[model samples]
Structures are given as structure tokens and as C-alpha cells.
Target chain A: MLEAPAVAALTILILALFVGVEVISKVPPLLHTPLMSGSNAISGITVVGAILAAGSEHDAVAQWLGFAAVVFATVNVVGGFLVTNRMLAMFKKNPKSDA
Target chain B: MSSTDLIQFSYLVAAVLFILGLRNLSSPKTAALGNQMAAVGMLIAIVATLMVQGVVDYTLIVAGIVVGGLIGGVTALRIKMTDMPQMVALLNGFGGAASVLVAGAEVSSRITAGDVPTGIIPGAIVASVLIGGVTLTGSLIAFAKLQELMRGAPIQYPAQQYINALLALGTVAACFFLGMAPLDPQLFGLLVGLALLLGILLVIPIGGADMPVVIALLNSYSGLAACATGFVLDNSALVISGSLVGASGLILTKIMCDAMNRSLANVLFGAFGAVDASAAAGGEGVDQGTATAYTPIDAAVIFSNARSVIVVPGYGMAVAQAQHAVRELTDTLADNGIEVNFAIHPVAGRMPGHMNVLLAEADVPYERLVEMDEINPQFPETDVALVLGANDVVNPAAREDESSPIYGMPVLEVDRAQHVFVIKRSMNPGFAGIQNPLFFKDNTMMIFGDAKKVVIELNDAVKNY
Candidate 1:
């Protein structure tokens, strides 16, 4: 329904949404914390956009905005991944129990 | 291939990794591997972005990442497991803020260069800012509530809904105007203010008991904010990954709402905060039947004699930091040949799976933590049910009391066990502010005290027996 360039990206977004819903709904309660935390981390993909903004050949004022964006995105990326790992590390299965 | 083609190809691979990563997170066995794969995907996306044509300055980028990395890394490592909800809320806020700042910078710079955005770019920028702004402040409010910096009760007033509706309409109108005229800095500033204020007002009316749903919804907003920023920049990687997270958070929000037997709209605006005024004034719920107080010694007697015992824990266990103490009882009961398993309701603690995180931190095996649906049938065959700091989850009112506010919410049927011992501080209603008839049942005994102290006493008694 749009231009050639926007169409490909929009199509990707639509397919990814379906993939996300299908895959995430299968996660059991056993890993709900991890699932939520992990997906939250993936949303930090905005780091790509932030990085592009920061490094653009714009004026100093614009570059500073990119700088601020980088810091916030970095926090989400770093904190989210580490916290998910710590929680995942705690999940243990009993070798003897069938469940 | 050209460098442009290389970046595109890398993003495609990164997207695939993200999908596979989430797929792997479905099981306990591969969950950690799933996390690592997503991390790798993030790294690839970042590296490929750095290879873009206009990205020449490294000093500011490196400095920001270093500073942010230190702060994010230290906090993630230092925060207690009990504080995970707040931690997630705070990080989600940062994600939103980053999208806002990034999009704001691009638009401001383009304006400065006398090249105001036309076509869909203006709409995309407005969406990114509006959604990101709400996600930012909304997440902070959620963090404040979970962190106890703000009151956990629902703060409501007359015409709250009308005010929210008006503000929402005004914001939408301003956004539409911005898309049409793109140069009114004053209007842009007004839009930003309205977005932030709306976020706060949206979350303030919801009580702490529903913060999980609010946080899940805010998490979705964060992802959607990023997706809009992707449209602003025409980046497929950001759009793909962001929408994936958006869909995931929406699914979680829906699951949490269903567990509480509430709708998404109800959770956002229901103000489920007004507790029964009469019960609050009386200083305690109506203790219809007698609740015979049982000592730890009596609890131990049941444990030693019973063949199987189910432990039902709630937010009270988290508050008292009693997971480790409860684990001791689990070990003691198992030593005596009692089949010990934990019954976990879907919404037992402050957040979904909150109880499981705390129990896992205390070395509770994954196999022993059973979800409600699977363990409900087992409760009827169990010899005893040990309830710690949990009230509403075991309440029969959910299934039996049609008039109750929490009717039909799935709860752990702890009352079905042959004998039930509930450890609580008093006869107060649960966080949902409802009276639990399960405590007054003929087979139930109230063992009142701090959860940790009571659990320790029960462990010692069982060990000595």
C-alpha cells in the first residue's frame, strides 16, 4: 500500500510480529521471568537507530542528542542482558525428578 | 557486495538470531542459550550500524556506551532478586527514553539544516516521541510503586476518566497538527509535555497489585516506540526486532490479565484499589468461623505424619525474605519421606512468576515448582498444605463467591488438601483487599507470625521430630 522502500520494511515488521506472538505464547510459566526480561532486552534494538543518529554528520547540537540517546540505549542493552543472565543462571532442574 | 548490502545482510541474520533466541527461551533447558543468542544479535546490529556511511565520530559514542555500560552492569549485578520487577521497569524506561532522544535529535537537526521532514517521516517522528514519552514516564511510575517510593494504592478522584479522555484527545489532535505543519517548536514542546503527563496519569490510577499488567503494557509501548523510530529512519532491523518485542509484551500483558480474570481496559482503568470500606474500618476482615492458632510444634506434627505436603507461597513470603527458610522445610519434609512440592499460582507475587524467581534464588528445583493447573488435582490427594504469607490465592471465594470482586480469578486450591496451615501476620485481607474464607475453613489452622521466623520454627520442629 506504500512506496517500494517502505513496503519491504513494513512487510518485515508484520512477519516479525507474527513470529513473536507464535514463539512467545509457547513459553511456560517456569520461565515467565526470563521470557519477559529477555524480550524486554531485545526491544533495546533501538540502539541501532540511536547509534545512527549519534554518528550522523549533523551539527554539534544534533550529535549531543545522539550522545544522550546512546547512553540510554546502552543502559537498556547492557542491564537487560546481564539481568536476564543472572535470572537464567538460577533456574535449576532436579536430575532425579521426572517433572 | 557493497558495504550497504553488507549491513542489510547482517541485519537480516541478526533478525533470524533474535527469532531463534526467543524460540529457545520456551524451555528451561535452553533458556540461557536463548539469552546469549539475543545478546549476540544485539551486538551484530550495533556493529553493522557503526559501518554506515555517515558514522565517522567515535569519541562521543564510545564515551556514552562506557558510562552507560558501567551504570547498567553494576545495577543489574547488585540488585537483589526480589527487586527484579523494579529493575526491569527502570531498564524499560531507559529504552523508551533512548528512542525519544534519538528521534528528537534527528528531527531537530534536520530542522536546523532547513530541511523539514515531509511525507510519512513527520508522522513517524510524532509516533516515536509520543509512544516513547509515555513509555518513559509510565515505566518510572511503575518502578516507583514497585520500589515503594510511591504509595501502592490507586490514587483516583472525581472525573478521572473524563480528564484522561480529554488529555488523550488533545494529544492526538496535537500529533495530527504536527504531522501537517512540522515547524511549530512550541506545539512540539506542548506535545512532549502532554505525552509525559499522560504517562503518569495513566499509571497513577492503577494500584500496585496490577503493576505487573501496567509494566507489561509499558514494555509493549517501549517496543512500539522503537518501531516508530525505525520507521522514522527506515531501518528494517529496528522495526523487525522492535515489533517482535511489542508482540511479546502484549502477549504477556494478556496472559497476566487473564490470570487475574480482568480485561486489558479494566486493568488500565478499573482502579481495583477501593477496598471494602467496612472491612477497612473494622481493622480486620470478618473472621466468620474460628481460626484456631497453631504453634510451630503443631505444624511439625502434621508434617511428620503426612505423606505429601504442598507449599503455597505469596507476596508475603517475598516481603519476609522467607524463601530460603521455606526451602529448609522442603528439605526436612523430603528427608522424612514426605512428597514435597510447591504450588505456584500464575499471579501469586507482585509480578507473574515472581514467586518462582525468589524460590529459584533459594535453590528450589525447577521440577518441584508446579503451576496451578497441574497441581490443583494433586491438592485433593495431598495430606497437608503449608501456606506461607499467601491469602487470596487459596480463597474459595474466587470460585464460590459470585459477588466478590476477585470472583473467577484462578487461585491455588490449597483448601482442597486434607489439612491446611496458613502462616500470616494477622487476619487482614490480601493485597486484592478481599476476605479469604479459606482461612476460616474447618480443616484450616492459622499460624500467625513473621513468615521467615515461622518457617524457621517449623523447619526446626520438623528436623527434631
Candidate 2:
């Protein structure tokens, strides 16, 4: 829809799909929770859409919807990252760190 | 470079950071840094998108970010690790809901001004709304079940499947109608409504036992919805990152299903209340078994004398917050020259790697924990199999009982060990609802109590041994 050709966008989409699957094939089972939560944070990139939605001056209704979208997307982004960090923080190896 | 080029370059940079972050996340040592890298990528993408043309007012945008960030940050920092599955589910739901709002705003604004595109935009909007709506509600239901705010068992009524089928058909029909009359908010609203209902109906039939798969699948759905929204907006960043989430999430879901030896269809539609059904039917054989019981003192003597012990922890261990106690018990055994190892079932706790985190929190050495496949063969040579608050994963039925609902699934071969001590609160069946015949076996002894208390008592007893 923008200046980028549809074919190029689709190309990115297709290649990303393949790389996504390949990157996660060997994640150790111990890190599965962090992996899921970490990838979850990546999906929070939808905050991009939320920012555009909120800033667009379509109409009062559209503005309100956009505002709400920004809020939810922000929560998804901020919360997902913080929670993932907390989980991964526990995965450290410590012979003397155990309580 | 022009602003457009800058935006595109920033997106490219973000995508590269995301890829690097994902690569680093594969190992335990680098995961935290990987998460930080992805966060920085998201920040760059957001800041760059803020510079895009359509954005007008900074007040509402700033307000939304502050309020939402405060809530999300506080909750994430405050929640117990044990409640993480539900937190993740809720976050996934918020992502889906964000997509629905963005897509809805985009389409409704366009339709309000007769700005309909003659291309795939309409279809993209519909897909975004549909998937986003479904993901939002489905994740909410998942969160509720995990939080115990709703029943964790499958909730089915007569003709539930038929009703779900009708809802799916109606939602699709509404989408087609909206495609023709994009100006009609009523039709779009109906599409969203039906999709939301379908989401609830879809997840409610699945029990808590299958939540890991459900959570991962819903996470994937959120990504797909965002990807569709990206197409509607022609935003390359969303499309790329969303596809990454959708693809990796699907793989994780498959891993969860495979770990449990169940297919995706079985997880989604198996409606595993058959155990409850037979129980309600009041079959005598199902209710007739009793397990041999032991005390903490008795377990202490057995554990102290054993040369090697393998501890298996499960959902009950999490509930009892006994990971620390289990660690102490292990330490006591170690002092007595016992080699202690932990066997972790893939779906051990409410979520994937749940027990691992809990064990790690108690400072149990990571090297001492072993996966199901790797630890299965070691059980036979182990002097004792200590099951603390674990159930179905250790059930011999998966290996021996052909008629059991969990018959074909792979389980820990704890029965192979020379002596099996099951520390539980009672003889209740686990989440799977089927009785564990291992409890009544000749070598298995049940020590009944709160897992944390029992483990502590055992630790004390062993200390004095």
C-alpha cells in the first residue's frame, strides 16, 4: 500500500516465516518458557500499528479506537518484555546462587 | 535519506535485531540479553513509526503509553513466576485486541469516507479483525482457566460442537457480507461479535491439561492477526515481526503437542473429560484402588539408604512451593553419598519449563535437572524414584495400560526404578482424571501431605539419620 512493492513485502513475509521456524528448532526444553515469552514480546511490535492508529485524524470514533489500541499494544510490548526478562533472569547458572 | 527511507531503514534494523535476538535466545546464558535486544528493536520501530505522516496528537499517544506502560510494568514485576502462563496469555490477548482495534479503526475510517481499496485491503482487514477478535477472547478464556477463575476441565453441553460449527459459519458469512458493504459498521460488528464467541467456544472445551499447546497456539494466532493488520496498513515491520512470531509460535505449539505425544487435533478436540465421564458413570473398578501409604520418617529412612535417587516434580510441587524443600532434601541425601537427579517431564507443570523455573528458583543446580527422554533410561539403575507432587507424567498406564485415555502418550518410566516413593496429598487422580496404577504397585509407596511440608519433614528426618 505504501511505496514498497507488494512483491517485496510478500517476499519479506515468506522469508521471515522460514527463518522463524528454523531459529527455534533447537531451543533446549529448559528454555521453552522463556522462548515462548520472548517471542511473545516480539509480536508486541504491533505497537507500531497502534501508534499510527492513535495519531491518525480519521474522526472522533477512530481517534478513540486508536487510543485504546495504543494502550493495549503498549501493555503487550512493555509487559511482554519485562516478564520475559524476569523469566530469563532465573536461567542463570550459579553453584552458589541457590537460596 | 528521506523520511520514508529512514522509516524503511529503521524497520530493516529492527528486523535484524529481532533475528539476532532470537538466535541468542536459543541458549540459557544469552536469553536475557536476547530479550533486551528485541526490546530495543521494538523501541526503534515505534519511534520511527511515530515519525510517519498520519500521526497528529502527541498528548493521547503519550498518555496511552504512560498509563499502559505503568500497568504492564508493575504487573510483570509483581506477578509470581508460577502465574506466568496466565500472564503470557493475558499479554497475548492484549496484542490481539490491539490488532483488532487498529484494523477496525483503519477500515472503519476508510469506509466512513468511501476510501475502499479495489485490491486485497478489504480481505486483509477482515482477516485481521477475525483472527484478532478470536485471539483476544480465546486468550482470555485461557487466562481464566490458568488462573483458576473458571473451571479448568472441559466444559461441554449437548450439541456444543454443532453450535460452534454454526458460529464459525455465521462469522464467515458476516465477513463476506462486510466485504460487499464495507461502509456498514453493523455487518463488521457482527463479524467481530461472532468471532469473539467462536474464540470462547473454541478454548472452553479444552481442559487445563492441554493449556501449554493452547497458549502457544493462541500466541501464534495473535501474530497472524498482527501480520494481517500490517498488510492493511502496508507496514513492513509488523508483517515481518508478526510472521516471525506466528511461525515460531506454531513450532512451539507443535513441540508441546509432540512432547505429550498428542496430535494438534487431539489437543484441540480430544475434550479430555472422558475420565470424569467414566467416573460419573460410577464404574466400580475405577474407584476400587488404594495406594500404600508411608510417613515422612519412613521416606527419610528409604532415601537416606539409597545410593542414587531421582526426584520428579510436578504441578503439585509448584502449588506447595516445595522446590526449596526438595532442594534441601536432595542436599541431605547428597551428604549421605547419594547421587540425586531430577527428571523433568516436558509438560511437567501448568506450563512448559514450569518446574525447571521453580527448581531453579530454589537454587537447584541446572545440571541436576534432566529431560524426560534423557532421564527415562536412568530410572532403572536409580536406587529410588521420588515423585513429589507429580502425577500423570509418571503414570505407568501410558506404557502399560492400553485402554487408558493417556495410553499412547510417552511418560516417565518411574516404575522401572527399584523403589518408588510418591509424595502427594491424597490418592486423587491427576489432571488427566485417570487413576494411576503405579500407586498400587508393589514397589510404590505413597506419602500423603502438603508437598512442601512433607519435603521439609523428610529433609529433617534425613538430616538426623
Chain A TM-scores, one per candidate? 0.86, 0.84
Off-target runs (Cα >4 Å) in candidate 2 are A1-4, A96-99, B274-276, B279-289
Q: Count the backbone clashes (under 3 Å) in each candidate.
A: 0, 0
**Model 1 agreement with the true structure over A1-99: per-residue lDDT tens digits:** 366667776888888899989998988887887777787788888888777777877777668888898898888888888988999888844535532
For each candidate, the DockQ is: 0.68, 0.63
DockQ value of candidate 1: 0.68
lDDT tens string, model 1, B146-254?
Answer: 8999988888889999999999999999999888866567777788888899999999988888877887888888889989898888899889888988998898899
Which candidate number maximizes DockQ?
1
Q: What is the C-alpha local distance difference test score of candidate 2?
A: 0.85
